[model samples]
Target chain A: MDKETTIYDIAKELSISPTTVSRGLNDHPAVNKKTRQRIYEAATLMGYRSNTFASSLRKQRTNTIGVIVPMLNSNFQSSVLAGMERVANEAGYNLIISQSLETVQKEIANAKTMFDNRVDGLLVSIAYDTENVDHFEPFFSRGIPLLFYDRVPEHKKCTSIVIDNIQAAYKATAHLIEQGCRNLVHISGSLKVNLYQERLKGFKYALMDNNISFSDACVISTNLSVEAGISAAQQILQMDPMPDGIFVSNDTCAVSCLKTLSQAGISIPNDVAIVGFNNDPITRIVEPNLTSINYPGEEMGEMAVRSLINYLDGASDVAITNTITLRSELVVRASSTRKGEAS
Target chain B: MDKETTIYDIAKELSISPTTVSRGLNDHPAVNKKTRQRIYEAATLMGYRSNTFASSLRKQRTNTIGVIVPMLNSNFQSSVLAGMERVANEAGYNLIISQSLETVQKEIANAKTMFDNRVDGLLVSIAYDTENVDHFEPFFSRGIPLLFYDRVPEHKKCTSIVIDNIQAAYKATAHLIEQGCRNLVHISGSLKVNLYQERLKGFKYALMDNNISFSDACVISTNLSVEAGISAAQQILQMDPMPDGIFVSNDTCAVSCLKTLSQAGISIPNDVAIVGFNNDPITRIVEPNLTSINYPGEEMGEMAVRSLINYLDGASDVAITNTITLRSELVVRASSTRKGEAS
Candidate 1:
């Protein structure tokens, strides 16, 4: 019920014209410093705030970026969001965030909302069932800068920021081989996602490089959830000959599988080596200290925003850069380190 | 750059007046259903998204809520955000979120930005060192419908959604005492936060009720991080007679302490019993599953947004209802179960 303070009110209070008040507030060279100080003091006393909405309409920029993630509760996504918030806030841009909840329908709806809201730019990690990029066609046709991170689509117009998942997964698998694990199993997510598909490629490539036979049975496609880990462990328990090495797509699932396997009387590293992606805190907390790929979630998030902001500000043209890949490395731990193993 | 498609473009494309297109788009009864369909088709063809800025200026509403949390990377905060997002999306409201990074200065700056952006309402979980509510006074004065969850401030105008921390802590401490623990230690966070202060009170009250002498020496104030847990364990080890029961304020710290103590040759439940708050997933993964309080972070988040939105929509008067307490319970596990104890 209270009215918003406007330049007109400040002008009336200071006995100056509204034009003079606006110029003074905007720090125009036409306005003297002494008058500007008096105007600022009056404006503060009256609780005057510049109307961002009206100004945004005139400038055709909202100074806000929209971020769409598959889900927000995951450790990796949250870390990425933290990084985005840090960078965006420092750049004086607000982030309007939404979750697709891993559903393509919801992803489409979220995209529509973000587009209608007129965000200056958008950063997205597509949903699990996002079969196509048709939903984002409006952004592309309108020439609104769009960037994808982590789970990206193969779009020539949009730049993608991601870790080299194929390389990361290869390192994880190769480390298991070095630990004397011959019979290997890879716990993968939905291969429909490019990242998961690339990881699967990495797994097969590693097996081929090591002269190990590759079969479809060696890869178990799962949602990569905690419960999925337990279920995967049960499935492994029923295998003709249990796997000597396991590489999971994520830390949560890997840790869960390790615990379930340990509970089932399987010894870690000695009998089976395990490697997980994402160097989450739980990797260290889990017994034997899980060997994991340091995914650099925060850095990826920072880079995505920085690239998009730079492109928007014309400081850099991210459009020409197809993909920005951050470095990822395997962190050797007891989980994948066997003593007296074959060279 | 491509220009935005306006109602005029749709009207011109459809060979109709702009007024007819606008009314059809708004679904005015004066416009026939056939005309509305034609307007929708033309709008889609032209990519005519509703100008939210200009419309919001007329309605004095942005349909966006601002949320400020201490940090975005924490498990609990992420879960809370997921809940908020689900509810807000269903209600057709957007969430512009930011993190204070546990600094009051950042919190103040975030609030100012939110105010300038004209979010319809605000939900806040205060930072570690936020001692006063002065930063949020503008929202309070503007009748903008502000609510706080978890680490809330003591404000009359704002309704807070939180679990009863004192009761939850009392339950945890009482569970430890019932397991035949006389020497008890409580690891807490900064007392500046009301939630932490209340937990300390509960710990002391539980000791008093059990006829055990309470001492300030029995309490350890920490940042409650994983590293802090290790430091607390070292501090406990140095005590002349180590405590028999330990209740940590959160799962991350408690699990860390439990692991450190176990590595130091202390047998859990037999040598010392431990209880943690916020039954995080790590509680189950720890060697001996940790006993913890189920804090219901998602429920808290949902409740906070529901209350704020209800008040904003005139469905409820949240201001009259000062505090909304959700249920929190002790989840007993292997960490605190002493076999054949005195009880």
Candidate 2:
């Protein structure tokens, strides 16, 4: 690395006071326009870059937002991040992102790193295993605004942005039943996650509304990965009475499971109707295109950053808004439209 | 925002000199262990988060790497970022990312932000219209290591990690020819980008080798988006002598084109054989299973970061390794196999 040129170096080279150089670089009103121009030219000639770290020490503002996500390799998360980036960038804020790889220990470590970096605010979609958020105490105690999206924790000090998972799930389940499904199975992610737990509730409620008795065998909890989908399919195949319908937590798993069941000679929507959450692109390509919930990932992300920035800039009181629910809708596709209906 | 606690606040509360508090905070050996413990406890009570900005001012190191990508909403780029995060986290470094939105202006703005942040190193996949890299002069002049991947510019001061686009394209084109394709259409991205230009060259070379007549109309330079695929398919349908095969730059575009063609009563492999680059998950899900080049995005990302870190740490001279080419393979699937061969 090359030696960084400080304001002092510019001052010494230009025969000016270090204070004047610093003031000029900062565009202080006290500095003369001509003198500032000279300082800038000299600094540019020396390749003197502004040390944001040093400037932030005096200003107590970094103009950087910290973002911690569950994983980066997902369509939903990527869409959310793209939305966050658009809002944050337009507002002249940089986003520093970290992934927890679905573990609490890593989440804590990531939170610590964000705290150490002194990010102005934090946006988090916490890991699946992050049962509690004692690690985020520093942000609360120090009055750093934190907003959670998608997968969130309930806290008085934080604002959460999410879609109504239960309503979406209920719609999906009821749609499957309307398509002539009798016995149904719901493939869920870790029930520890609020979204999955709420989805489980919706599935039960839908069954009850249809006068069908639900049992423990109706729910299959897994990690909600592509591989998990295959195993869940195998488990479903071994059941005493086969499920006529299946609803999965994510499209990746749903698509995989659908393929496996089809390879086993099961006709989609004839033998089994399927519904998946998160209308990812994979849903469109899969044969008998999977029915899915249109999770508002991008909107949720925009709301998270906008709320945090609002709180930071005193434009609005994010504290009063405990949770902001974005709209989610069921996208009925070929996978669930059984009775000779077009997708 | 709340008031931040400082060492001076601790000193005043504990009735000790500010120097003692500062030393204790730094874990200085000169400070007594008992006083250090007391200071630590008091600091915790007061939410005295360490100001890394101030510390970095003295240390002249931030342990942060800046990454600039074309787009975040891409399957290939997401996989790359996942790999980058894994390697950077293990190396005890933080990643700050920005997207160019496939524009040179945004790319320039992102570069300035990274420079102002004083990142230890930078990794960039240049934007679509990035004709020259004069905007990257600040990093170049400051001698901060800059590494490019996938999309790159010819820069003497930088290292690039990329796959052999020409070889991958050649293999794809040759495979289609082997399957009895008389005339082929190449759906390419902006020719301004080196990768697309190389692929175009490969496409032309394969046609010349097969003794087939080619025209400028045979090549379609597009944005390579899903919408672009539909438009390209329309163009193909209007050709005087319809091309028997197609090779698209990305899978998203390829799948859309295939869907459009199929909906228009065009048969796959029989009417048109197709191949795509970036063997994304969508390739497998699409009907007839798109044939594509397995571009090693994760490996490229890992190699880019590893080289930049190696350069920053003085472990290796990335300058000597101007360009590092990772392995790429043509995964022949049903889309391009017209000779009744299995995938």
Candidate 3:
């Protein structure tokens, strides 16, 4: 790499003080317009870059946000990242994102990286088996705004943004019951994940409310991959009394299970009514158009960044706001709607 | 924010020279093991963070790789990013990523930000309408390793990692023809992108080889979005003589078009054989299962970063290799197998 041009060099070339060159570079009103224009032209001609890293070090704020996600390939996580990137970029902040690949060890490494980088704030969606969040104490002690979004840990200091997973799950279960499903099955993610655990609670509560009692065999815990969905479907097929309703915690898994059952000659919404979370694009393309919960991934992403930025700008105190819940609703589609009066 | 502890503070507390403190932190041979262990303990107790910012400025290398993509919400892009993150993180380099959002303006802004941040190298996948390469002049002038992948610009100084799109497209088209299709329609992304243009060339060449003269009517230039797929399907339905084959540049659009056509009572393969690019997970869930080209997105990402890092480490010269093409294969499935024996 070539040695970069400095403000002092530009000042020397223009026969002016270095302070004047710095002021002109910053577009300070104290520097005359003509002098600022001359400095800009010189900077461009000389390939001079006003180093954001050095200036950020001096100012004690990098104006960059660090985001650690469980995975980058998921529909909901990517959507959230897209929205966060939009808001952060619009606010003149760069986002440094890393995927933990669903490992708490990797999450710890990523948190340490963000701390070493001196990011203004940090946003995280914990890994699947992240039992403790002590790795984030450095950021907390340094008074850097730290916030969590989906799949959050139970932390007092961090503000968490999430949809009402319990309510959404309850609505999905209630709808399946309304569709005349007597025996229902739930395909859940890891019980360690707060969201999935809450959804399980909702599922059990809904069954109790509907005067139905189910055994452990009715619920299958999975990593929610497509292959897992296939295996879950195979397990359901082996049940003496097949499940009439299925609620999956993710769209990819639900679609996979639905396809597997359909391939085995089961009529959707007749033999089985299914509901999934995260209204991913796959829901519409699948046969019978899957019913799903409209998890606002984009909104949740934007809100996370907006909150962090607000706290950074002193416009709001994110510390006082312990938990932030975004509204989510159930979307009823043909896959879960059994009683149709018109058709 | 609380005042960050520096090595100088540790030195003062340990009653040691600043040089000894720095040497101990680096685990120098001169600074014995016991001293290093004590230094580490003190550093941990005082929350002393190594100043990567100042050291990076002195070294003129940030250990950060900047990446610019057109979007962050796509399956292929996310997979590519995942691969890039894995490689970069393993190599002790951080990736600073930004999205162009399919616009030249945002790309230019992102480029400037990367330049100002003094990233060690840059990886870019150009936007839809980025006709000029002047915005990236700083990287070129400064001897920063610049690599482009997937959607790239025609720049001699930059190394581009991509699959052979022309061959992939030719295979898709020839497969459709072999499935007994006479009239064909292609759903393509913006031609401003080099990959899409090369695919178009392949499509044209395939038609000519099959003794079919093509026209503009045979191509549907679209953003390849779901809505565009629906509109394209409407256009195909209105043809006086419908096309017997369809090729879409992306799986998302292809699946959407297939679903729309199926909903309109068009029997796939028998009526119109379809082939799509990028064998995303969605390809398998669609009713007939999609026929697609397996583009090596993960490999492409790893190759881009590997090339940049090799150049940085003086292990290889990337500028000498202008283009590195990865292998892609055709995945023929139910969607394009009309005369098949159900195998």
Give the DockQ (2 decimals) of all models: 0.86, 0.65, 0.79
Clashes of 2: 0
Q: On residues B1-343, what C-alpha lDDT tens digit does candidate 1 reach at each position?
A: 7877888888888888999999998999999999999899888777889878788888998999999999999999999999999999999899999999999999999998999999999999999898888988888878888899999988767688889999999999999999989999999999888999999999999999999999899999999998999999999999878999999999999999999999999999889999999999888888888999998888888888888889889999877899999999998999999974321
TM-score of model 1 relative to the true fold? 0.97
> Which residues of candidate 1, in runs, are more than 4 Å off?
A29-35, A340-343, B340-343
Q: Identify the CAPRI category of the predicted complex in candidate 3.
A: medium
For model 1, state the Cα shift of residue A299 in Å: 0.8
Candidate 1: Cα lDDT at B228: 98
What would the per-residue lDDT of candidate 3 be over residues B1-343, giving only the tens digit for each residue? 6777988899999899989999999888899888899899998788777887778878778889999999998888888898898899889888888999989999999999888888899999999999978999988888888999998788777788989999899999988888888899999998878899999989999999999889999999999998988999999999979999999999989998998999899999789889999998889878799999998888888888988999999999888999999999999999999988334
Please list the C-alpha lDDT of all candidates, in the order they appear: 0.92, 0.89, 0.90
The TM-score obtained for chain B by all candidates, in the order given, is 0.96, 0.88, 0.95
Candidate 2 residue lDDT tens string, B1-343:
6777888999999999999999999999999999999999999788888877767778777888999998898888988998898789889788998899999999989998899888889999999899898988998777788888989897777788888888888888988889999889999998988999999988888888889878898899998988999999999989878889999999999999999999899999789999999999998888889999998878877877888888878899877898899999999889888777755
Report the CA-based lDDT of candidate 3 relative to the real structure. Answer: 0.90
Q: Model 2 segments beyond 4 Å from truth?
A: A1-48, A238-241, A339-343, B1-48, B339-343
Residue B329 of model 3: what lDDT? 94
State every prediction's TM-score relative to the real structure: 0.97, 0.91, 0.96
TM-score of chain A of 3: 0.95
